[model samples]
Target chain A: MDFERLYRDHADTVFGYLAFKLQDRQIAEDLVQETFLAAYHGLEQLEGVQSPKAWLLAIAHNKLVDFLRRSRNQDLPLHPESLEAASSSAPSKLHMQEILEQLAEPERTIVYGLYVEGLTCRELGEILGLPEGTVKSKAHYARRRLYQWLQEGSAV
Target chain B: MSSEEYKELAWGLVYGTLSAEERELALHLVSQDPEFLEALKMELELKQRLAHLKRAMPEEAKERVYAAITGSRSQVLVTAVLKTVLETTLPRMLWPVLQILERSVFAGEQQ
Candidate 1:
């Protein structure tokens, strides 16, 4: 399945998503490996999937959710930097790096893939194994969520 | 266009997360709706800010990962085994021994 090419072409986005979503470098790296491994193995079985990008994303998303549920059940100690970012009055100065640093795990993956990776809705749908419709909807939802969070930054 | 819906579609479109049609529709809606136009500007700004956040994987790690995936460890192992076996083979070694024996017999007879 040329998994290496896939990993080379998409690994950064995948890792970025995982790192942001999982909030742990180690776990994110593990999930990235698992995601590629799943792609390596699952390529043979993915007949009905119309969008491969979305399909992969769906697998990755599920992996993320499973990891989150199994692990990270406890409320984490708040990062002081995020707390400080939240308190700063100059919201416009908020950089993408700061946003990424402050972002909780799931949102990080979705946002990084969409905005930073520059993946389209259809591409996301293919990666996640979702209908293009569903991918678009989720992306829309993700955007709104980001907007809400950005608004909350000033309040912090 | 509802402000909420505009907020959603606007960000999605600028982020490159929306389909081509949705982006067109969002733009159309923004043009027609006064409030949505304002929200669209904010969405655009947010997108610009987030655009700067894009990052690349570390170069060395990227190469290492590629090797891990595509490296032909088995091929190398098999080739090494074949070379070793050829060096140790019966007929291949016997050829050198026969050459040595031929030289001794011919050495004394050579005028």
Candidate 2:
């Protein structure tokens, strides 16, 4: 795989996923670097890999999980306010973030991955280590909840 | 099919994850069931709205990744400069020479 091209294509997506999950720009940025660096090292294996974006995102997800685990052990603050602070000037983003915040884990990630990142259910299943049927079900429930909330105008 | 089954199929349809048979079933449900149609509409709308929430990686963060990949900030800067030269300045500078060479080749062919 052409590493530079892959980075150009999916860096924003990987970074966005990390930033959304971590809620901290600096940590997300660090993780982005690490993710790409790991991809760079694994370039040979990436040959013939379909859906490089999903592959990079799976790596990013792993990185986020590791960061979360380490943070818990180290007592590091994830800086949830960072997302708020970053999006303070953009109400639409802040509003979206608020709505996303209302979702539970894995579902929140599933919704963001499927809708925002445009990842396939199979890709999400691979990334989240769940069966495709389970990913679809989670996505179904998450979408329904979001739809009901939006319809009620409660999340607006 | 159960309501849950129909909803799962609807989700599969939204994500394009359904097999041919599953899709046919979902479409059949969409035609026959008003509730299924409504759910599909809402799901599609939610997908559209959520798509708009995509975030761009900040320029600084992108630079960090580039630097990390390329080894250092200075290396990235140098690579960027070299790429610009190769893509733009060098091509323009060599254009006259290339034109002259082409003309010479044409003249030789004529002779």
Candidate 3:
């Protein structure tokens, strides 16, 4: 599937997503391997899928969640410290990061793509492999959840 | 319809995801409810803020992935381990069974 080129093109975006979500460079790198390995393995199945980037992001999301779960061994709250780097000196941005942590992974990715990648929801939908309508719904859920987190003091 | 009930689909609406019928309702709600409109605005803003956090992978990362991809070391390591396991463990596992069967056959012959 021209994997080297595909990896070259989207590795930054995938790494970006993992870095923010994981807040760990080492873990992010390891997971990137797993992500590519997974993508490499599943490339055949995903050939007809709408968005390989989004599909890879989904794998990354799962890997992140699994990593978090392993670390916490519970449905713990966001690693509060992870937000420190992103949020320091910018309270609103931190709030946004906190709010982001409250979102489900799909919602988070759609939000991340929308906010970070500057992709429209339709574009995000293409990447996420969801219908645009579904992608929008997730994006909205993410937004509302973030707002709720802020209003409720980043309640987990 | 109240914004609360509509939130299940709010992502779509915020992202202009409404179906023909739903769009009418969502637009009407947007006009009627300032709070709901504000929420949508915030969502968009939050998306922008989150976007600003993008990070580039450092150079070393590229090298690591490249090495892992091209070096063939891991493949070699895995194949070696598999061969060792098959050659050593497979015989060990079969030895007891083979011994028992040999004893049975030879003992019957002696009888």
Candidate 4:
């Protein structure tokens, strides 16, 4: 596989997904390196995968899960404040991000994967290891939760 | 279905993820209820707001990543550390956390 080409093609997507998940630019940047490094070493296994972008995303997803688990073990909480702190006040982006940070997991992941990354319910199901129906249900609930956040001007 | 359930269905309609039968239910409800229409509008607006958050990877981070891929490990590690140190505008509260993060990273590298 052409590693340079893969990095050029999918790095933004991977980085974006990580930044959304981990909500830290610095950490997301570091994890992007690990994700691509793992991809480089695992290129042989990727030959049969149909969507290399999704494949890269799944790698990024796992890297994030592992990173979070490790951080948890080390007693390092992932701070929504830090995510906000890292960014300048780009209002719409900040508003969307603050609401997303308010959302519970799986829901945050669901809505973000759907709207931000433009992943379909089927694709999200595959990445998240849920059935498509379950993914759709999560999307529904996530939107309601988002709407509620909008109405409240704060998330519950 | 309950009103809350219908609102959720409205979300499915707005997101285009509803099955045909689900879409039928949602449209039926949507045609009847002003609340459902409002919900659909809100969902669409939320989607638009999310679209605004799109950001490309920065050049420095991109170079550090590619450097790691090409086996310039030590050089990129130094760059990362130097960048962190030289970055003068980081919020005061984030500094200690960044130090902890660096320690964890270096600790992982050693093992």
Largest DockQ belongs to which candidate? 2
Question: Predicted candidate 2: interface RMSD?
Answer: 2.4
Q: Which ranges in model 1 have alpha carbons more than 4 Å from their true place? A: A65-156, B15-24, B29-31, B71-111
Each candidate's clash count: 20, 0, 8, 0
lDDT of 1 by residue, B1-111 (tens): 556567767667666566889888877876797777767776775666665444445677566655654454455578689757866775765868866775897796695
Candidate 4: chain B TM-score equals: 0.46
lDDT of 2 by residue, A1-156 (tens): 577788888888887888777778788889999898888777887866777887788888888889889989999977767766555445654576678888898899998887777677788988888899998888777877887787887645
Those runs of model 3 whose alpha carbons end farther than 4 Å from true positions after fitting are A65-88, A101-110, A117-141, A145-156, B1-44, B73-111
C-alpha DockQ for predicted model 3 = 0.33
Segments in model 2 whose C-alpha atoms lie over 4 Å from true places: A88-96, B1-33, B72-111
TM-score of model 3's chain A: 0.62
The best candidate by TM-score is 2
**lDDT of all predictions, in order shown?**
0.62, 0.78, 0.69, 0.78
* Sort by TM-score, top down from the best: 2, 4, 1, 3
The sequence of per-residue lDDT tens digits that candidate 1 reaches over residues A1-156 is: 355556667777666666545445556666766776677667675566565555666677778877767666775442324223223345554554565556554345556666666666566655555677876666566666667766676413
> True contacts preserved, each candidate?
0.37, 0.69, 0.65, 0.67
Better of 1 and 4 by TM-score: 4
lDDT of 2 at A15: 76
What does the lDDT come to for candidate 1?
0.62
Candidate 4 stretches greater than 4 Å from native: A76-86, A90-93, A147-156, B1-44, B72-111
Judged by DockQ cut-offs, the docking class of candidate 1 is incorrect
Stretch of 10 with least lDDT, candidate 2 chain B: B2-11
lDDT (Cα, tens digit) per residue for candidate 4, span B9-107: 665776777899988878887789887788777767776778755557888889877986777646667888987675777878888898898899999
